[model samples]
Target chain A: MRVDVRALGACNRLAERGAERAADALADLTGTDLAVEVTGASVASGEDLAEAFAGRESIGVSVGLDGGLDGEAVLAFDSQQADALLSLLPGGASMGRSAVTEVGNIALGGFLDGWANYLGQAIDMTPPRYFEADGAAVLPDGALAGDGVFLFESRLDATTTDLDFSIYMLPDSGPFRDLVVGKTATAATPGAEGAAEGTGDAGSTVVPYESLSTFASLAKRGSTNAADNIGMMTGLDTTVEVSRLRFVPLADVPAEVGVEPHAGTVFELQGEPSGYLAILFEEESAAAVAASMLPTEPDDPLGDMAENALCELGNVMTSGFIDGWANVLGTSIAHSPPEFVHDIGSATISPIVAELGRRQDYGFVIDAAIQTEGVQAQCDVYALPDERELAAALSRLSET
Target chain B: MSHPSSAGGRDASGSARRVAVGVGDLAVVDGDAALTTSGLGSCVAVALVDPTTGARGLLHAMLPSADDSQSSRPSARPAKYVDSGVDALIDELGAAGASPNRLEARLVGGAEMLDLTAAVGPRNVERAERALADAGIPIVARDVGDGVGRTVRYRPNGELAVRAADGFERTL
Candidate 1:
């Protein structure tokens, strides 16, 4: 369900007021000059929540809501930013848990209190739960069990300490949408015009899911190319079993693929319509693939030769993925030299997810799962388009 | 091997009931039953059992404490936070005919899992330990720390079996 522009604007104002109060509370508590800015707001899904925190490691403090509202209010800060905030407290470095807990209690509590006061409703908030992990780990299971979430994301700048922090409010979309739309439905017709005017200059537009099929088809073409290349390189009969372009919650990517450590190649997209491309193989599958690459050294421990083979494999595979996208969208996209990382799938992809999440609510993932005959080996190829570029590409397609 | 009234037939043995405690959840089971909590990454699951009575309770707490401004607000889910969750589990176990004096606690989970800099596992373990100590409940055994998620199963015989993601099973 699409959130009307009027509802988004109202929530934005509500969130801005909340952020101001939270900033004041933080300043009073820490004895520092703090400025809070409501950077942007959106109606996001559970997947969006996951995507927002994708590969970045942070401290997340979530307080659940009860009574009139049902959802969560989350305040997240990067580890460095958290330390910066903590260092400002009395003996903050040593005080750790209690200090962080108190900060979350005040800041997020104030934000929720603002919403409650504005709605003229009594909302009971649960005590904050502290999680120190990537976004997916911090979010509880079933967070996306509902339709979506209303996100009011803000930036808190501690002027005295030069620290910047992020705060997010994820209210249950059903209740939040009802509350905002109910209040503005009568005046929203005219406000819609105003919203169009406001958004016109920003040039930010939501690309519908149907249009993303264009990217999906391009991804399939790339995967087919990758399969053919794999067959030629390893003499293994490879088939692309699953290929699709879909919007997934950033946090859910690692979980989608098992969280186990996987040997993979990471490549950055450069030039026009840039993003990231990852070629990951499950541990056993990677070992098998690496072994298959060099028949002479079958017992190798995926050393330099195996890594180089994987990188070459990645280079060929990514060319297949990106070239198709560029051909379809009529944009030139260049990929950097492949960098190999053998780490947990989540840790490996978190940074890319975090970057994309920061720009947009939903992360568009072009995924192709390939299976090789006679070997229990499978490879996953991911093509992540930069949010803005994908939007622009889709806008161009619409225009054409 | 099946009772006519046995719905779903998941309980073919018909002797033991399996109680699943989800994240931010708590449960007390007595008689022939088992308490289980799965996919515990950075959360701690505290299992309290009376060996003599076979009365048990499990709590899967996410956060360290509940000393926030909203702690005074009624209707808060006690199992969601460590401090209150431990207390609530003890109270529930007591109500389930488990004596507080004879109650022995076993802690499982609280693993870092991911390679993030912020280590919540140790902190969660510490908070649960502290809460148990404050409540005067002696911790008999624990399988905590390490960077791996765990699935804990507490049987009626007071055997707490902890399994890692790699299929390694250890009984505490």
Candidate 2:
């Protein structure tokens, strides 16, 4: 729809001022010099909104808006920045969840309070709900379910802590447009009207985020099982940290994975919800893991024995991961034996992504980091669910 | 799967300029300049060069057609879709003093980078091929498919180099 640029600009300024006040509140709370500025404000569809966060992991806090408006307000931080912020608070490094939530509450509360003052209306806000997931998963359900949304975004850059975060407000387009432009409901923008015309199409069906979360939890269980299996095999204390599932643009995959050459094992899941998985390790990490898998320390770690060990490790890991999906979904999930490749990390995964890209614009990526105690080895496990299979799996979840 | 040939590095003589063509964008250049675009997964890069005049143009188009509602809008960017983008590129190349009859095309990218089951890459390739055929531009060589993301560099001298994510580079 044709957004009134002047009205958008005014709203942007108001949001920026509100964020500045929030920055003051944060500075007083943390005793740090912080700056919050309006970075971007626009109107976009759900797909385009997802594209803005393609391949990124974020932690967000969303609060429902009630008085004088109908929408959601979200404040998000990149995973790295969130970690940095977490480490700044007292007992934060060890117990970050509560502290992070507290921070989100204060920051977003102050922002909404200031905005209410600016608009001369009492804006009632619900308690903030903390979400640590990929960008796509964390987007408010209202935005995804609607044809288009009004996005007002701001960035918080903390100088002392060196942490950068973003705050977003997504308002239902109809009311937001009226509020911003002071226009009546009858004067709908032509663009919005056109977008509304295709309301009942198959493509517009909303895939509930709750169903996706079910799959995410299954992925977490799989990672944990894989971690246990690895620990048993290598006799090393291993732990898996599974990140939230994210929808990533196919073109941005290489950069997202750190485009260096890595040794990888590729596996294809064959079943109702079929997909591909790639486990990647940096050269040094591969050598370290391979060395640990060996019965005795090898003179040369890059030998066939090491490669075989890696392959076996891949097989065990894939089984642990996929078996969890099959069990939870009540379906059979078969997987191909791992195929090893030593090349640029992106190149190894590109073909798999290409296979998916042939059909869809975006692919789902679930990243699991495998860490072993006292070993300088780290393995990244990536799970890409086939689009059709993903849909089927989600539908089954909703049905059950 | 052939070993990558040495093909992508720019000339060190400091004479050639490098121009990057972003997604949904096109550019035409002459002389020692090289036009490049990266992160091409499922999107096709149509590079046109006139051998006689040393003029080259690169169009990075994301979708197959401009028949969508968005494109129907007057504010739509022409270079975003294959149908209109290819035509725009040809017009721009002609504006740059290149003869449309003498233009030779090289297609890169349109690789399926995700297992989405739709075959967007092949469709993109097909659309581009159809558009170029309609425009009467002959495609000399192409590295269009097989599920690998590629970065393409097109020189005015008709040297079209494509480098896959594996660091495998080949001149087509």
Candidate 3:
């Protein structure tokens, strides 16, 4: 089914509004100041979603939904913040998991209320189920089994206290598709713009929902190609850990990539789907990966020789990345020579995102994580494709 | 992974209240409180401080101007754009009992970080400077136009500390 860009933007905005409302509810209940720091609608495979929260220890509540929406929603708290969150409850720190569950229930209710109001139908929710484990375990079973799932994720922060939480909504494909399909159909009807009126520019392309999954697979292949190139260059066993497409607000792009210091190379892709690409590694990983490239370990991992080696690796990987997209779309894609950068993760991406933010409020970030088996070496490859051009390319692929 | 502590409530003097200003957001505080924002690349952090009144406002803006944005209407988050964000910061400090004429601006961030791209960093810095100039607000100090990301912390006492990712720290 085709989904109009306008409809998706509207849904994204609603998700933000709903998360804000949820934060308000939590604030009201706990008597603490809270805010929604970031919100975005994303398309990712189960493995990608799992990988996102796999390492961190978290506690959360999951609930099933029906009526206006059919899906499962998970509200997770960083376990370290659990004490702060628990302290806000009337029962105080002694309440523990039950209080956490109640907070989740109220926040999810407030969250779904916006969607329900928009759909003009009540969304019934099942009782909250509490889960405490590593990040991925918070998600219900079978959530990690899908090829692609539409997810609305938001991060909430508390101002007065050191508390924060994340809400992840996994909507069932059939019902979610129907929702988008219906909204887009209405958006296309003359004089019935409704929800889609204020969101999109005129003449936006409509992309088939399934095509997003195809693009995800395309990203996976590209990342796999990159991993193979890394293996060939470093002679280390490297593999693609996760690959997914995330649609996020332009302003949040930097924070999404993260704030930690990173060593990377940046390139600009020039072609049918011209955009920017960044291949980043944590400091230690960068050192390890760079050292593996040279005959002997470099005296300084970020010195001239290591920087050149990393740039060369980034060049081949950039080729491996866009080459998949180029082959599949039957178009030629060229990339600028790499620009070596070793700085805060967000700093490396904000300029690119800011440039894109001038014309588009949202960005399609194709993210991939590559890991070397025997060392503390990991790489994060981000490919931000020109949204309109990518939509056009994907639509053409669907047509074929 | 754990979040980077936006909580910088402790200093040499004593314990102070801390507020974090996230991306495309702003915050204003008075008295023994500090305002902080981090991970600023091309995004500019504009701080308005009234040393006389001990009131301060911080804006973390991503884009130069909302006028240049695709949307024609004013954004709900006015602080997301520098021109409007500076205006909002001035107005907020005014509400906090700091006279608009008494406010002096100190800027941080606006780094290009990566080379040969659209010059959003320079544009953001220029836009902020113009906005402060237009409002008859003088810019007291600034640390900008570099290839680095910064985390900034401002206290009402007129101390604006900026720490670059490369372990360089400066008080503007």
Highest TM-score against the true fold, candidate:
3
lDDT of 3 by residue, A86-197 (tens): 8889899888888988999999999999778777789999999998878677765556787777778888888778888888888788888888767655543322223543
Residue B149 alpha-carbon offset, candidate 2, angstroms:
7.3
Best by DockQ: 3
Q: What TM-score against the true fold does each predicted structure earn?
A: 0.43, 0.57, 0.84
Q: What local lDDT score does residue A115 receive in model 1, on the 0 to 100 scale?
A: 68
Model 2 lDDT tens row, B1-172:
0011112234544567677665567888888888877667677889998889898888877777766423222323467677888998888889889999999999998776544235667877999999999999999999988767677888657889888867799999
Error of 2 at A89 (Å): 26
Which regions of candidate 1 deviate over 4 angstroms?
Answer: A1-287, A300-368, A372-376, A379-400, B1-15, B20-26, B38-43, B51-53, B60-102, B165-168
The CAPRI-style docking tier of model 1 reads: incorrect
Scored by lDDT, the top model is 3
Of 1 and 2, the candidate ahead on lDDT is 2
**How accurate locally is residue B135 in candidate 1, as Cα lDDT from 0 to 100?**
82
